[model samples]
Target: MCTAAEWDDFRATGTRRPVNFDADGFVHLSTRDQVHLPANRLFGGREDVVLLHLDPARLGAEIRWEPGVPTDPDSMLFPHLYGLLPADAVVAVTPYLPGPDGLFGTPPLP
Candidate 1:
């Protein structure tokens, strides 16, 4: 688990994205901004959430997003976990792996 101080450090960096931890103990940082949707689908739209796993070392990050739920009616879409994250939630630090573009690398889904 990450300590409060570490979490604060991540937030202080001013980065707005979820960090992820891989099964191999690597960390990945997301380079994208918050997802956006149509005006009528901001809150009550289908659930589109990002999934992040944290490394025990606190030195890396990994990031993933769940497919949007068709039943959601929100205009803007941000990756999030349904019923898991709060409205004002932000994940600053996470485990990541180096990618070809110098960002976290994502493996092909099976």
Candidate 2:
């Protein structure tokens, strides 16, 4: 997920990637069951974000399973994309603004 402003910048550039992706050589993605926790942990109280529903088949990057934060259990692995995410890979874009008080709850998923 990314902020609304960040999305706008991505549209202009045709590529979407966070600073961490450049620093770490991969873009981070969380699973449906995992996103809420990380969202709260990393973006608590932030209301300007957007949820990007991606289609892995549309991805132009190389994705690899990698260990999550070293603090987590050693067996945990997450998908890391080795290149910028092209807009085409994003099948849907929904506003992820938090509700009042700037807190997020589990989002409805399909």
Candidate 3:
């Protein structure tokens, strides 16, 4: 997930190197079921978050399944993109808002 402005820039440029990409060496991603973990951890109460639904087939082989933070379940492995994220690879985009409790919840699948 990313801020609305960031998403807009990504859509305009057709590709993006997320802020943490340089430090982390990959674009962080999550499955529908696990997205809330990172969203709540990183974005929390922010209302500017938006979820980008990407087409895995278009992502090629640079994707890797890797371990997330220690707080996550031991079996959970997040998807990390090792290259620029092409905007065309995003099939959909949706506003990701937090609840009144100031924490993100799992969104219904598209």
Candidate 4:
């Protein structure tokens, strides 16, 4: 997920390198079923958050499935892209607002 401003920048540039990409060496991605996990952890209570729905085949980069943070379920794996995220790869973009409790739940399906 990214902030609304970040999404606008991504559209203008046609690509995006997440803030942590340099340190992590890959762009973090979460499946539809698991997006809420990280959204809540990192962006909870933030109304500006937006979810970028991507088409995997259009990514034009190598994707690796790796274990998530320690707090996640033991068997869960997340997708990481080794290159910048091209804007064309995003099939949809949706606001990811947190609930009144200040926590994110599963986002609406694209």
**lDDT per residue as tens, model 3, 1-110:** 79999998998998888878889998889998999999999999999999999999887549899999999999999999999888889999999999999999888887
In angstroms, the error of model 3 at 14 is: 1.4
Write one digit per residue (lDDT tens) for candidate 4, span 6-67. Answer: 99999999999988889999999999889999998898799999999999999999999999
TM values, all candidates: 0.20, 0.83, 0.93, 0.95
lDDT of each: 0.32, 0.79, 0.90, 0.93
User: How far does residue 31 in candidate 1 sit from its true spot (Å)?
Assistant: 17
lDDT of 2 by residue, 1-110 (tens): 88888888988898887878768998888776566656776788898878888899888879998888866568877888888888878878887756687777667773
**Order of candidate numbers by lDDT, starting with the best:** 4, 3, 2, 1
lDDT of 1 by residue, 1-110 (tens): 12344445545764323343222232222223322221123322222223233232432232344434465444534343222222124533233233343332232221
lDDT of candidate 3 at residue 8, scale 0 to 100: 89
Clashes of 4: 0
RMSD of each: 14.2, 2.1, 1.1, 0.9
Measured by lDDT, the strongest candidate is 4
Looking at model 1, report the run of 10 residues with the lowest lDDT sum: 35-44
